[model samples]
Target: MEDAKPMLLVLSLLVVAILPTLRANIADFDEVWKKRAEDAKKASLEAYDPHPERVTQNVNEEVHEALEGDDGKRRNLKKYNGPCTATNPIDRCWRCDQDWASNRKKLADCALGFGRKATGGKDGEIYVVTDPSDDSLLDPKPGTLRYAVLQPQPLWIIFAHNMMIKLSQELMVTSNKTIDGRGANVHIANGGQITLQFVRNVIIHGLHVHDNKAGNGGMIRDSFDHFGLRTRSDGDGISLFGATDVWIDHISMWNCQDGLIDAIMASTAITISNCHFTHHNEVLLFGGSDTYSDDKVMQVTLAFNHFGKGLVQRMPRIRWGFVHVVNNDYTHWLMYAIGGSQQPTVISQGNRFVAPPSLFAKEVTKRGYTPESVWKSWNWRSEGDLLLNGAFFVESGSPITNLDTKDMIPAKPGSFVARLTRFAGALACVKGKPC
Candidate 1:
């Protein structure tokens, strides 16, 4: 074992020497990242308020008051009396229409919370992906999924048939693109994952993204006009790097090498809704590092998701941001769920949390290494959540009062979470019927 130390040192030095050769040089990365970061900070601060969830609470209170009966038992308010029972407000916006396939752009208008303004490809032409192969990282074929996402013009991309696309490199998506997988069973697995870097106004819906592996850094095209050298990926299923106004809905993700979804580097104004996540360790991560103080402007909404079995922790572990965790179903976790650091604001309202059977880990929140003296002032609140199986949440900071509710939308209650998230994952939708 003493003689083998010299060989190990030689191997480590050789690996370090050869790593830089794999990177292809792109001259404009710093410029692009800086510009996008500035824009994201501006947009996020414009939408920021001290108590962001105040609007949601006001709307919910008004709704209950209007539906109250003579005997003080609240009557059920049937917002959508259609054939299909779309329980949640997001699903009720468009799921009841029989012509959803023809009017596919209408889904862009149905987003709530911070991502409500993300109009992905709403004014663009429809581009159907006829090929599922991602054989080339640069100069892809015209009818391939890679080509459609790299086009300069805004596109509402759809699949022609059921396909299992194995990407050879990271799929770098451009701005103003919508990849809609409603009418087919589209799966992106067993290879590189999706990357949204320095882009905005993008929506990804109805896809299965799982089983990803990191790729060796190489030259890849991000848009029609440009291609850049990418570093080795971290293997997240969906990575948002300096991205804003993004909406991800109805994606089934599991078994990735890193977090299932990661939004970092000042990414804000995003919503992740109605997704089914299972069989993963670290689930979601927002605000990558504690020292990235620009993340103070970050704001996101995690709504109506089903955090199912085989998960460990970080059903978002956030830093320096305001996160509205509303109406999600947390049924399993091996470790503590919903962690944070760096004085972030978390408003957990109307969620169901069923703790794991472990007696050592029954708490729902973990404030990462920070002492009580430092973290006691952080605004972390739990309102109207259903805690079961000896679960508990640690609340801190003072509650806000008399917030202006001029134009705000309410999030649904956690009592109806089972019904609201009944169709959390990707759905099998026929062309003419309601989805």
Candidate 2:
């Protein structure tokens, strides 16, 4: 007891000496994060689609049901039974209930990103795609996926039976439409791919899209009124060009000829969630060109997706965009994952990354096509990420080491990522059963 006083004094002095530097570092981090947050909000509002037929809300103002309660408390399903209520915030918004089929439209409210306002045909007619054929690009048949997409009216599209749809040309999805493949085995494969250009308010869900081939774009009908000449498509599973307010969920894709999903040319307000990606290279890209600076307003959210098996790089290689990549699981990669260039701001939070065995490729980050002298200034933060199997993230930009503040508590502990991403893909559900 006599020696305790000296030891206490020494510890107090040490803390006094270190506190100033720690506080400075934390303040700097907070300022940087604050600016990024403000800029992201501005971008979301600036890119808000002004389509007269629909109301698109500001993406940042929306609160997800799973993340916050009515009075703003984080919620979990400890009170509920069966299949373990999803801990991932998006899944908890509507996954545990047995009435998901009946309340299918509830999925729209769970969207988190620039595209959060995409209610998708909820206010319109329900159209069923009964045929698997796309015989003519200029004149699509009445009962096919192509026909359902081309209609100008707001529509909730569903499949009549289990089938695979192979298109002769890229299926140009029109605005304010939802291609819902739930409750059936629906697929688009060995086909000409899906194109969303100059459109708005589109939702694609619960489909297996793979083995997509390039199409020779010619005089093809894009909407109910126009058919324009075009060039050959680059054969992506899904391509978004100059589109807005789009949400893609519960998709299973593999072996596409090019990128699985490509959002380019000022596409904004987009969410890509609950999809399973495998057997692909160059998985997702946010911007097509660095010079297309109009894409600076692009704000995207990638959450609750599984980047699995045989993927190479570009788990969303972004350019000039504000992207939130949260709670996704990355299990396999031949090359590095999560790269960016051209001043993209990426926030990677609550994700798990298990790298491959190659010592040279164990790093989880790469700055694409840019010299360190330039890329070093870009903001790419990894918070609460599990870098397993010898995986390490090469961090750059402003150091955010000390965040001892209440509001800016860094993402949940990295150890918790496993539980957060466990249910990363589509739930294999059955009728008269819980999902």
Candidate 3:
């Protein structure tokens, strides 16, 4: 009993010492949050695309022309002579260039869909990450990924070599940053996940992020000017909270503890493209809550991705907002795919959905927390989508008119998806050679 008293006193003293720092961090973050919230609101408003279907049509035409010739006829790949057979427009922009290593910034212009304007760190200097360790959160080493992302200035971050980074806490990324993991094999696995909170204009490409675990957070540096006490993190592969103008492409992910990618808390103007997802549940979530009505302004584009085997449900279960699910390949799902609630607008176009052999779960759409009377008015439409093996999509709301069809239904059919997503997921890029 006498020794217990000393231990209690020691613990109380430690708490007393830490309280001041925690309080200061909280106060500082309050101020930062206010400013960031305003910035995110303004950016999201400016970045929202009301007619994103036009962009999808443009890309579809490009992909069609690439696979078939300009004469709108099919071509035999066996007779092709190009250095790289880039199937899609985004990949065609940089994949075939021999000098891609030296001109890496050119990739910023390759983004399409709602996030096309996210020129992440394109005008900023290149910052190479030579260290794979996240030893310190407050005073991170100079050449580490933590340091590269925290800098207030825009930076194009690339790796020095093939490396695996096991983070100790959630990696907080700042605005105007690009984590480009090309020309090297980089993996973020078996540790903490990534968090993009209250930032804008970020691009993450060409990496494998899997096996993520939740982080017990403390004081973590979000930017060079801000370090705050963060709480325990959700174990998502990537979490976007109140962020805008973000693009995530060419990533291969599986076995995360939570949703593979989540965009919530009014996050908008984002794109997830050319990625491969497998062995995950609740694959994507757009809105965190049904009551968070501010998510009505959210707009996202899911393009040219491959949802492979071992996936269960929520190939993006949305809540409120506008989403364009375009030109993707879905080969497997144990449960219903592409679900929603709260009267969101979802337009599924030019995609392929192959249902599992089980007849109980072949439906493509699932509406939650709403009765048939309410959800029947929601704008959920599927155009040019291929449903194989008894798969189906339940569409609702008013029939689209010719005026609306002019802006909405120009995308190619699902038959083109096989060629469009042929090179999905991360690619192996060698210097002086095509990817």
lDDT of 3 by residue, 190-256 (tens): 8888888878999999999999998877888888987888766778899888889999999999988
Give the candidate number with the greatest TM-score.
Answer: 3
| Per-residue alpha-carbon lDDT of candidate 1 for residues 1-435, written as tens digits (9 for 90 to 100) | 999999999999887554432211222455665565577567556655555666356434433443233232222433433457565667877887889999999999888777777888888999999999887888999889899999988999999999999889778888899999999999999888798876888999999999998877688887897777777777889988777889999999999988899988778888899999999999999988888897887888888899998999999999998888888899999998899999998888778899999998799999999999989999898877889899999988755332345544444456666766777889788889888
Candidate 1 Cα outliers beyond 4 Å, as residue runs: 1-51, 54-83, 400-412
Q: Estimated TM-score per prediction? A: 0.87, 0.80, 0.89
> Using alpha carbons, what is the TM-score of model 2?
0.80
Q: Give the per-residue lDDT digits (tens) of candidate 2, residues 1-435.
A: 888999999999887555422221122234433443355445445665443112111221221333333332333413335564566656677777688777777777777655677878887788988999888788888999888898989899988888888888788888789988877888799978898866778899888999999876676776776566555677899988767789998899889898999988677889898788999989999988777777777878887678888999999899988787766788899888898878987777667899899988899998877998888788777877888999988766765443222234344544554455555544566655656
Candidate 2 clashing pairs? 114-269, 115-269
Candidate 2: regions farther than 4 A off: 1-45, 48-84, 399-406
Cand. 2 Cα-lDDT:
0.74
Badly placed stretches (over 4 Å) of model 3 are 1-29, 68-83, 400-409
The alpha-carbon lDDT assigned to residue 332 of candidate 3 equals 93
- Lowest-lDDT window of 10 residues in candidate 2? 52-61
**Better by lDDT, candidate 2 or 1:** 1
